[model samples]
Target chain A: GEEVAQTPKHLVRGEGQKAKLYCAPIKGHSYVFWYQQVLKNEFKFLISFQNENVFDETGMPKERFSAKCLPNSPCSLEIQATKLEDSAVYFCASSQSTYGYTFGSGTRLTVV
Target chain B: LAKTTQPISMDSYEGQEVNITCSHNNIATNDYITWYQQFPSQGPRFIIQGYKTKVTNEVASLFIPADRKSSTLSLPRVSLSDTAVYYCLVGASTGGFKTIFGAGTRLFVKA
Candidate 1:
């Protein structure tokens, strides 16, 4: 079985501060995806990566949010100048193909 | 992108069968239908997937109609632990490979 690992299960930050979340995809998985779940709502796609290259960032907020998958390093999502609305459970998922996906437990972010 | 619509919620009892249906009228020819289950405070887990006809696994079964416009996920003999939100997704694989989830159906299994 494959598992995606997410760090900082819970995080509390002040508004306007910076928040960073990390995710380690399952070994041998080639595609990584980030999603945001707000207030128990549907998961919203944020960005996706193929290996170290970003394949799609259409769902990401261009100005304040950025994600990267460095060589041999776990993927990271960084949010600058966080707002109250930024509070949500961020999930990371990885898959080798289209049929199945393995997701991390998720990181809950609370901004006040 | 194929848009999916499912019931907002459903109720069932322990030892009973539960079937959740999803509709995707604009599904593409190459799109696949996948179902996922999510418990509170956790990520969605894959239940089953199907391209057409019927596919069954240990956890659940997926029945896709001939037109591919709709599909049903059947959970047999559900238990209290089966109470959670179930999401149905329809999408085509890109070079990046992404799956988009709709609002999903919430299943409440009573003991």
Candidate 2:
């Protein structure tokens, strides 16, 4: 079983600072997805990438959040001018099949 | 995209069989029902998926009736460690994968 790998299990940032997170999807999986889990315990879709192209980004907050997945590089999610409400867990998932999704351990971001 | 509805929370005793149902009234013809379990501070883990009829695997079993409007996930002899949030997702496979996770059903297993 392949696993998606996420770095920096925990992250802390001051308000107005920048925070970055990384994810390494499963080796052969072509689709990568990023989700944000806020305090309400809901998984909010942020963005998704198919290979090196952005497949969907409807859930992304364009003002302060951005993500990228490039060839031979791990996907990254960056937040500019972090706010207190930005504190939550970010999960990265990768899948080769439509129904089979493999998720990473996730990065817990805390903004103070 | 199909929307799914499920229970907000459920309680079960250890060693008991637990079944959680999800309703997807607007399920498209190409949509499939998938379930995922997530623990605190962790990512969601895939449990099972099905299009129609019954599909069983080592971890759980998914039962989809003829109408395909709803599905159930049956966990055999649950343990305390099974306490987690379960999410139901409905989506088609024609294009790139884009799943919508609704408010998950939280299951608390008692000892």
Candidate that scores best on lDDT: 1
lDDT of model 2 at residue B18?
Answer: 96
Candidate 1 achieves a global lDDT of: 0.91
**DockQ scores of all models, one per candidate:** 0.63, 0.61
Screening candidate 2 with a backbone cut-off below 3 angstroms (N, C-alpha, C), the clashing residue pairs are none
For candidate 2, write residues B1-111 as lDDT tens digits. Answer: 788899999999999999999999999988888999998878889898889999999989999999999999999999999999999999864345578888989999999
- TM per prediction: 0.97, 0.95
CAPRI-style grade of the A/B interface in model 2: medium
> For candidate 1, what is the TM-score?
0.97
Using DockQ, give the best candidate's number: 1
Q: Write the per-residue lDDT of candidate 2 for residues A1-112, one digit (tens) a residue.
A: 4788999999999999999999999998888899998876778889989888999999999999999999999999999999999999999998887666889999999999
True A-B contacts kept by model 2:
0.49
Best by TM-score: 1
Kindly report which residue pairs in candidate 1 clash with one another. none
